[model samples]
Target chain A: MEGIYHDADLKDSPVSEKKTVVDSPDIAQTSDFSNLPINLQLDSEEKIRLYSQMVRIRRFEERSLRAYQQGHIGGFLHLYIGQEAVAVGSVSVMSEDDHVITAYRDHGHALAVGMDMDECMAELFGKRTGCSKGKGGSMHFFAPDKNFWGGHGIVGGQTPLGLGIAYALKHRKKKGACMCFMGDGATNQGPFYESLNLASLWGLPVVYIIENNGYSMGTAESRHSAGEPLARRGEAFDINWSVHQGHDLYEVRDAINNALVLAKESSSPSVLEIVTYRYRGHSVADPDQTYRSKEEIEEYKQNKDPINLFRDKLISEGVLSDEKANLLDQAAKDEAEASAEFAIASPFPEVSELMDDVYWETDNPDQKVSSGEMFFESSR
Target chain B: MPEITYREALNQALSEEISRDPNVVLMGEEVAQFKGSYKVSEGLLEKFGPDKIIDTPISEAAFSGLAVGAAMMGMRPVVEFMFWSFCYVAFDQIFNNAASIRYMSGGLINVPIVFRGPANGGTNVGATHSHTPENFAANTPGLKVICPSTPADAKGMMKAAIRDNDPVCVMENTILYNLKGEVPEEEDFIIPLGKARTVCQGNDLSIIAHGRSVMVALQVAETLQEKHGVSVEVLDLRSIRPLDLDAILDTVRKTNRVLLVEENKPFCGVDSQIAYLIQEHAFDHLDAPVKRVSAIDVPQAYSKALENFQIPNHDRVLAKAMELL
Candidate 1:
């Protein structure tokens, strides 16, 4: 009876203050790179590099969209058109030991981690020369050698995996962290909460980055989520939580850098919500007009485009000129076009190679350890 | 060779593997401090330390997925599910991430993780906790499923599962944990996956079974020999995914009359697949249609009497074998 709850003791009130905005207004207002924190500050050359990387992602996504329209590319293309800074900026702050894994919208992360444009495009074309050898199209890209774990297709599924990577690092006594990126909608998933509890309880070096791009597919965040500031859910698990605007590459770099430092130094996990916008529909197959309006899409494009914002910032700081900017943009466009050509020229995977990568034992015949029939169907 | 319980044999395998490889870690609910729910991981936490033998929160999805991530990074993690029925909560991680990560990455990544726990019904734990998922696990192409019926096979197959490069699901039985059998003490001793063991040789009929049902089939074999004067062969399928088709075909060719047995349900059960393979490959060799003795096709009941009739037992299997004779 002592442990039992009664209606008389229950009081109905709001869980927390309804603070909708997670982004820091101060960081958004700061324009001068010199005034930024020393850890957050970037050199002129590095700034230009980040700008160039964002441009490259935008152009590559645009090209892939074109291919999808032309019927050359099949399946869903979750283009990272508007949220380039989230990938480029976060990846730039990572040490060589650090790793990354993300949800379906993963092309931007793949390119940011230095995956070749040709292979990425070929993968979109479902060619053998692709990153996953045409086995994993659009949604799945992997470069383990580069510490980029995968382009996992399932929503909120990669959260525990990211935690595991960090768990492994700690288990092996390695100094690094894993940044697990997911959409705003992924917060509602059961595994994400479970991951949060474990990450905080074990003090694992993992940063769960929620890219709050205002919409979860067609549903707005206000409709899909109940409480304000999704990252605050980390507080329940005793994890450090914060939010910042993703449009500013500097802010994105700073917030992510701080979280990464907490992971490496303290072996603690943090949840940082990066408030951003996506111009394209959830996938190309999704018609943008269903849940959102044209004016909302145009508004984000004009005011908060990550690529244009960074390019203009670089130009304003005298780190890049108008002519140099145009040249870089043209170069990105050319590179994307050449990647499409490479994908076109690349051959599809041979039918013989269909079962090649299914198992390690099957791949290496001499070291083949398991007995009996591995595959149900025979290629011969 | 020392005779040991199925639980002790599994413990030996985990201990030997943990001592051999630094990357191997034992993690699950109550696995460390509690020494596992079934005491299969007894003395592991003390021998291997907290880092190697970890106790996780009752979050199967997180821990299962965490093991997968660690395996991707070259760490061999052996995760125990308190009960294999609990694995349904982490189905996405076990089925999608663990099973397909290797192939999806074009073989760039290998999930060298092992999920081991008892997956048996008839304890009257009700329908929720009583689920034999070996069939479901084997259905996935990227996964390897093994059901060890004896202490020796359990030890050898568990060691094999830990060392395997792909995700392996070891389906153990709670009732079989206390069963004693001779187990090899050698640290390097391992039975390769996907190989069938001929428990007994006969001329009349073959009773093909795996896991707990294999024990039932063996009992039926004994009764058939002494009571009915019928020669019954018992074949134990240790691994389900890389199924021993050659051994299956050979036994069917020898005995001529085949009777498949399993603890799984009749529909899409491991026996169903075996029955299909027999009819497909050795249909003409069969004296009669390959009959199956599987768990009754319904949700497992909680009542002792009904549950007894539900799971395949010695009497049910003996009756089926007599029909084949």
Candidate 2:
């Protein structure tokens, strides 16, 4: 390519060219996460939110996977299974004022951030009442009222946007931060590096959480990634870097809350890579067995499952009862069913609605870009 | 009205808008400290301070995407690309994020940002620097693609683009930056996008153009009227995305002959759409087939002669108009 479109020159060089801040040589389990700076144990209300949100995301994905099998979701259905603990954990530390953006596997992110389940289900069904009004299907869900930016389809595309939102927060002197979620696969993209560099240079209050789910689609991290661990790449930009155990909810929550504390106190960016794995394929179409062995998947599900680990920890610690937890899970499944019903009952969007909302309704009637301008009738 | 360079007109608009709203910001390579790669942002950094006028590290994708995020959060950011050709690096962010955010969010959110930069071919800046991507922006839905010809239109459109509730890509041409013209001195002056400006009136042929080519249309129209006694009506399409086809149809209906001109390649260029729309809506009004003069299909060459041959000049416009007549 003649222009900046070609990346041929960047082929030889891998992701990073600098060193990370390990402080200590050991990169092991290290310490008891229960003794974090911030209180990791959920309060009564926070406990309900944390537990219900995780269960809600789980049941929603299961129902959506079934819906996809039934030919309801026409396009790529990236189920967010095995990532519920990460979303729930990170979102738990976030306040309503904080802005959130993530990559395509965002069903969990939506539910975790309190998006209306009915709207989300309707969006998957491509109904008018969907969160995106049928303009964006499964891959794109946005709830500005809840401070959720979107489910960006382009990989690593939300990183810069997240950084920009953080810049806006810093500009306005607002006491809020932005959380950008991306997959390990997105680590290879150019914008990711650019965003990290600028976020650190400008000291923007944003935390980048890499849901490093072992694979960037079918390829393993060893094949695609140059570095052993993804979090260490942040050192190139002098960004604070750490790895969080995604399979455990307590660790994920504590780690994210710790990251946010550093972000707020310093007004700088930090990279937190959650070492997780997705149980499902990249999309609904993939068999998922092509890259990884069946035994590995079964082992992760049986032993290192995020929900199971959280449930066991809660049960053993007596923070929650198994029966009460079962009730919560059942309630979530029932809510998912009700929302699915609501989506089916909802009507398809009007054909005319396709033209509306393309541009905002302007104050000046004559100046409206799409309202009464061009081929359409200017109704303003 | 006072005559000023097209560059100063744009500068005045930015200074005015920055003063009008605190949320409005400027960010790009050398835009602040160096006063812009072109002098369009001269004295902006000093007047507005570093907080308002920011300089980036040539990270087009990240900075433009950042602007998109800022705009969504109720801040108006005006991002300047050194050249519009560099916009390709941020294509996903500009088209996917900036343009689609509002519609995809069900009107709940929007990005009120403007990506302004030179998108012309006559600068001899080589194939890499001299891309006319107005058609690219115009092709994408949810983006307001504005290209102005004169200082007045340049100043006016910049103001309107800053106020637009959508992502507006202001495709300025380096060739016209220093070109001086009579600009309105009114503080509240602004020319809304999608409205075409009449350069000169004629009865024989309508030469409709945009960007630097609009000057060619005006010169050709003036030459035809004085030398050959052929009166040509010239129309400057200030904005292309929300194209003012009504103005084009009105001109076609009056003159009964049309000659569309542009610096972009003939294949899928802005004029191609205009020519198609002309025949589609004003088919009966035409006395002859509507002709178009566009840049030759090639990666723009660096040599002066090659660059000149690539862009449509007044002679080419005149010849095309005569053929249409």
Candidate 3:
């Protein structure tokens, strides 16, 4: 807990014997969103829908954990179990053409963006039919049709790419905003702040969504973030920004929807700070229960479980029967299982494919045939 | 033809490119109002306005990425990094996004983007601002790296790069910006990317160079031919990445000797690549090993004397060429 504060300043990274720690016991509870005005906007059906989506993400993640353990998937896997509402609420309002680019934790966003469960599961299994043509594993999922750009691996790497997508959208006279999702840990990167300043100055249509899920992997936000409030960074750049409870799906949806509308109308960039939590460790491999305590996880689950709270609202308003909720959960499970099976049966890419997509084929006689397809076809 | 400085030629090229293509736009810090830091973007904001001539915050990563994205969405964006040293921050965007996007998108995306900037040791900018990054860009695939030494070449290449589908890195030497030369009057004339220019002709030995080294090699060639009684062929390798291997091979085949000059570091430098290329293609014609005149393997120092020693110069080119001959 004492080291969590120290861990924030990477200049002094704590040398723990264990490489990955799960929990941050000293993570300060900063806000009680239930009392905020943003909380009052959630109606029963909306709440239940949000809760159902969160549950879907959670259940899907649990199944994925088992699959990974059973050797069904390979490469790095980042789960969005604790940070479900960030995706569910923010993505709920985006149009088909609006862009969403994020770092590795992308399953929830993929689902939120309407990528078929089977396809997503297949992609994770490295099937050719998957979104990235089996080239990208779990951390590289992309659905261009859904305007979901990537599962960028590097921390704060997508910040500039997101800005570019927005610039492109604006340049082409497309009235869609780019929602760039990064973690609180990524904010430590100099590019994160630099991107904010540039995005705001250009009046680019971008929504920088910092899903402050406490840890930047194992390092807690309290330890990593400098004295400056992460959300208020937008104000320094004269960019419009607001901090809200990320666990409250209604709050997140309203904030993102409002931000998108403002960006569309004004052609300006905005920042939305979603104070959320991630229940699972940074990756599938880390237990994450070490840095933080069980009591804290139980506390958030008991007090601020977005899915449970929404389910209760739905039941109280008679919007859904317990039977319907259980059925949807079962359906999601079956979909994940079937996709995994399909992916398992699928074959890996052939050796010939290794040389494809390297260059654009323009006719340059000097170019060697061995260079493959990616070359300028200049007829000189 | 009009005699103008390299910087003026660059400015003229910008005006011509923007006027020629409605999609061509310029972005960089101090590109608007204040003209340009080096005045290469002077009078562009007034002509193109803020939308087309954007002055970005000092977020190289963000704007560079933005330029790549804009290029992907059917726009030709010309971005300026004030100094070549500052380009390190945006290498990811340049190498990963701008350069790799077309290939990554399965050729669905075309990054017709130009990253233009001043580079090389000059005016005591110290180690940070004095790197010649042609070799780095050349090392990256899917990028067209050009370092033109003449005003005419700068104008022609800048225009070509603005229109080229692949990402092009146009490295302008900071010290050469003020150097004057005759540029052709034709506004539409464009020297294609990946092509080299033979600056001078000879039969005794060939001098392969680019950017500032092109000027140095030309001076060295004139001195060697006139004063030292050596017939020197000077080849200005205008583009570094898609090297002009044909010219290099033919010249080396005729002369049977070569001196590769560059202002970058000796290790993995552009000069080494030229030497390697010549050896690979025209080894049978080579009468002697290709000699290299390059900056010493050390960072650029603040002291002018040390900095000069760090970069290959005219004397060094002449001396290296004489030894090879």
DockQ for model 1 equals 0.79
> Model 3: runs farther than 4 Å from truth?
A1-56, A70-72, A168-174, A301-303, A358-380, B102-109, B185-187
**Model 2: which residue pairs collide?**
A372-A378
Best by lDDT: 1
Q: Candidate 1, which segments miss by more than 4 Å at Cα?
A: A1-34, A38-41, A378-380
- Tens-digit lDDT track for model 3 on A91-117? 877876688988889899988887776
Q: Rate the local accuracy (lDDT) of all candidates.
A: 0.89, 0.84, 0.76
Clashes per candidate (backbone, < 3 Å) = 0, 1, 18
Model 2, CA-based lDDT: 0.84
Best by DockQ: 1
Chain A alone, TM-score for each of the models? Answer: 0.91, 0.88, 0.82
Task: State the displacement of the C-alpha of residue B177, model 2, in Å, after optimal TM-score superposition.
Answer: 1.1
TM-score of chain B of 2: 0.98
**Which residue ranges in model 2 land beyond 4 Å of their true spot?**
A1-31, A362-380
Order of all candidates by lDDT, from best down to worst? 1, 2, 3
Docking class of 3: acceptable
Encode model 3's per-residue lDDT on B134-222: one tens digit a residue.
88887777787889888888898888777676688999987888999999879787887667778888989888888888878888888
